[model samples]
Target: MEETRVLLRNKDVANMVDVAVSMEHGGYVGLRNALLMDGAQVIETLRDSGLRGRGGAGFPTWMKIKFAYDAGGTSKVVVCNADEGEPGTSKDRILLSTDPHSIFEGMAIVGKAIGAGRGFIYLRAEYSYLFPILENALDSARKSGILGKNILGSDFSFDIEMRSGAGAYVCGEETALFESIEGKRGEPRTRPPYPGTYGLFGLPTVLNNVETLANIGPIFANGVDWFRSIGSENSPGTKLFTVTGNVHRRGVFEFPMGTNLKDIIYEVCGGIAGGKELLAVQTGGASGAIIRPSQIDIPLDIDHVASSGGRLGCGTIFVIDDSNCVLDIVKNTLEFFTNESCGKCIPCREGGVQLLKLIKKISEGRGSVIDIDTMMDLSNTMRETALCGLGHSTPVPVLTSIANFRDSYDRHLDKDPCSKCSPERGLK
Candidate 1:
């Protein structure tokens, strides 16, 4: 199916980087509309819209605004999480590099709604090339009277600053992003003081990723009813999927929420790269569930993926063909998490290395059946006890691969292995 473009807009328009081009296409319409409503009214409008965060969390957008709004602080903050660090995910970068004005507009609207005076866009270090593009967009917006003091000539004054991360994957986590923005080491913080109540500089903050913020401009531009009518009942509005890995057409595509995974793979992605037999599919991120082909028919929405034992996190899809072994693929995922772990907590710091060791053992044709069972036990413990999502979710791919593709693991137990199982090129 063709992309149902709502968020990805006006690629054909010349000089899209210029504010005038964005204005030509009804840009800042949402901010103009939002500025008219009271903070509580804005929150209620979002509630009626049924918008959830496009980030991995799948949290209700309205609720986040309400939390920061109801936190009842004069000095609140709005954060745009542009740190798109998840493996196989590039949707945020696509939005920021192409449609940057909308992001700034969204942040300004949130600042007005929550009574925030200043906002920050935490751009990932890997995306430093985008800094100038974003800055150019910001300068254009400010000059056009869309940002800076008294936006659009209103008394409400708000401005946004851009911050760059230092290439830490853990900074993708909300709290870690805040820490990095504060000139500290990027590491996840303890809960009970969530971003809504106690956030950046100890101010009540509303934090949403780039795609989630981008949706705000469109939702108000076209009525909320239009957004709600497009996607599933629970998950309203279009979703951005970054399709990569062994696909004939690998890029960002937008589809309504609840689009069938089978259709996404077979049609949207143009089947596998070379008509190869599809072996497995990994959704969400590197640590997302390893879904078997038989399970691909299910809807690709937050609730559906959760109910079906997967995560629709960041809307990334990694397509694996028959040539690669599941064990090797999972080993690579574990290795990434092992390297990315902040080492602040014991379970994740120690468990990652231990999990990597076990996967290496199993992939090298050195394991018995007991090793499989042992890995599961260790993964469960980490999931339940880890300090944050990094530790909790690190084991998802391993556990999901074990549950869905047990035969792959069993094959490694045999002395004679298939061509797909190679120990030398364990992880790439």
Candidate 2:
């Protein structure tokens, strides 16, 4: 399968981060073109391009912008979610490091489209190393008259500031991110007045992930048809997937939305590490459902992956090889959500802890059929009652692993455990 290099096109270009170099290679053309058109026209073009939110939710980008625009208020804001905290997801970090200017340009375009004069980049603390690079990029953009009041001699004015998160995985949720930016404890606000109507200091705000915003520059640079021509009808254009765990070539790879999972694993990533047999893959991230070996041919689009009970979350493809135990992986994944739970909601707080304990019991060969049943029930409860996506989606790996590999769990309950999972044995 051939890879499309839209976001990663200038990755290998020398001095790619330099503002002059970026401008020479069609950097701010989208913003410049967008500024010339009416805000509604830009939104219409995005809608036609079939550009959905790249931040796992798969919401239409134009709808979000239009909502903020229609909400009708002053002090509207545009936020670029750069807090790439999901495990195995590094596409945003790479984009911010390599093409910071493009993101700034995208945010500016979004600001102009939504009638927002202020914007923010909510950066994750883990990627603190890229702080200076982004700061330098912002400085360059401001000096070039791309940011600040009266950008490029236009009536519109927009400027962006960067904020660092204090390492909370749940903060990846937009509302929680807004709270963190406000210097409060990071916790998700109940929705009803969604972010478009009321967000960030109680004003209308348009929030999009780094990758989603980055796509704006190109969508406007080339016509909407150009973007729609690359991928499937439902999910047009290329998406960056961060492939890791047991893959021979583990890094960010850009491919069309409907690219085959086999192509990504075998063709693009050079197959499993050490040529080992693939046991399963967790598409999206830790919260995403597990994909069995039989389902490796499924398309990687949002709708297609959802049909298979998975999500294209943050585009993190975590591969598991035959040498590893699925139960162990589930346990680790649940443990992460357990520790990261904000304790704001009882469902997530208690449910995550209970799930972790159950997985620990099962992994230690003390589980029974009843324990498995209990896990399913608890997962349902969490999914139904949890306040935010963190708790609601935390049981995905556990449920999918059990559904696809029940024998692995059953073996742990047997009097004579399988040699592969025996106490004397350890992961290879």
Candidate 3:
């Protein structure tokens, strides 16, 4: 119902901007506790904590660590995926801005977990403005003995470096991010050798999302049960959701996993803007599934959303109201995907163009039910066979829009009279 802040707990600590000030308020305590344990024990504590990745997919944090840990590369690395490029998702940026040390500490703990001496943060170009804040945090941590040579009086020496993205949305994908960091054109690499096995600079790397890494510090600072006690049985810990669109209070919220989407819209975000009726809510961002008002009652967790044929990807919740046509909004969304597509693969390269054209036809009153079916086929093809997640997720909105707003698409069968988007008339 309300924010159950964990990574955001630094907000309650005064002057958390300074690393020394942050330490006084219990920052880096996790890394300190983690350093006391061997690498295996550090990971075992994480396993007991029940932490999952906060970035879209919700993979288990401990398992991913174990993969790279067991890979036993001579030169292992830890990467913080700060490339928060998904539309309407700024939760990672919030953690980076408010309590950067937590992020730094988390990376360091992961570094120790995998016996990595160096860490890298692939920062989103849009978030380049936060560069100095991040630099200051790293510098402060280095000086405070929280990072760098023999951290916290242990042999686990770890330091973090930050890299700026080239404003490519595809770079948010782990492999693409690795390619960009290694001085290559940002494009998705084929799988089989996932990032954990072969990552940045050809080293076995444990790559984690910004929000996912942020949870690491608190997991060790507090006990396993403490973190596990917060959220659902399977989906433990809190989730940071960025609410936008027709919501009156549009911002990031940290609710326990499995928080109700309806409460988030009505109680947490003050419902739809004005008194307009809620038409749809798109979770996971522009690339997320579109949900009808009835489905908004679903829990905002990994398993629940997936079981309900949706995803809590990146945990961005976008609400739509009666004043806007669903076709109009989905067309705008497709335009973004089409423009941002890397064009490396056929499905995303060509399919996205076709999707845009079809959605535009419907938006401009020139589409048919046949067009809807065609778009679904094209989108599904991209999802199943595309090179990376960019193509995979790009179809989610188009497919879900057609599913939940079939009546809206049916209205545009031969002609669309929904241009003005008046609350009472258009697409209602």
Candidate 2: 10-residue stretch with minimal lDDT: 419-428
- True lDDT of residue 372, candidate 1: 92
Q: Report the lDDT tens digits of candidate 2 across residue range 354-375.
A: 8877776777777789999999
In candidate 2, stretches whose alpha carbon ends up further than 4 angstroms from where it belongs are: 416-428
Q: How well is each residue in 1-428 modelled by candidate 1, as lDDT tens digits?
A: 87788888765566667888999987899999988888887888888889899989899999999889989668999999998999989999888877888899889888888999999999999999999888888888889888888889888888889999869899989998889999999999999798889999888999998999998888777878998998899999889999888888898899999999889988988898876889999999897999898999989899999999999998999999988888888888988999999999999999888888888888777788999998999999999999989999999998999999998899888455446655664332
Name the best candidate (by TM-score): 1
Q: How many Å off is the CA of 82 in candidate 2?
A: 0.5
Write down the lDDT that model 3 would get: 0.86
Q: What's the lDDT of the predicted structure labeled candidate 2?
A: 0.88
Q: Pairs clashing in candidate 2?
A: none
Model 2 error, position 93 (Å): 1.0
lDDT of 3 by residue, 158-188 (tens): 8899899989898988999999999999998
TM-score of 3: 0.96
- On lDDT, the stronger of 1 and 3 is 1
Which of 2 and 3 is the better model by lDDT? 2
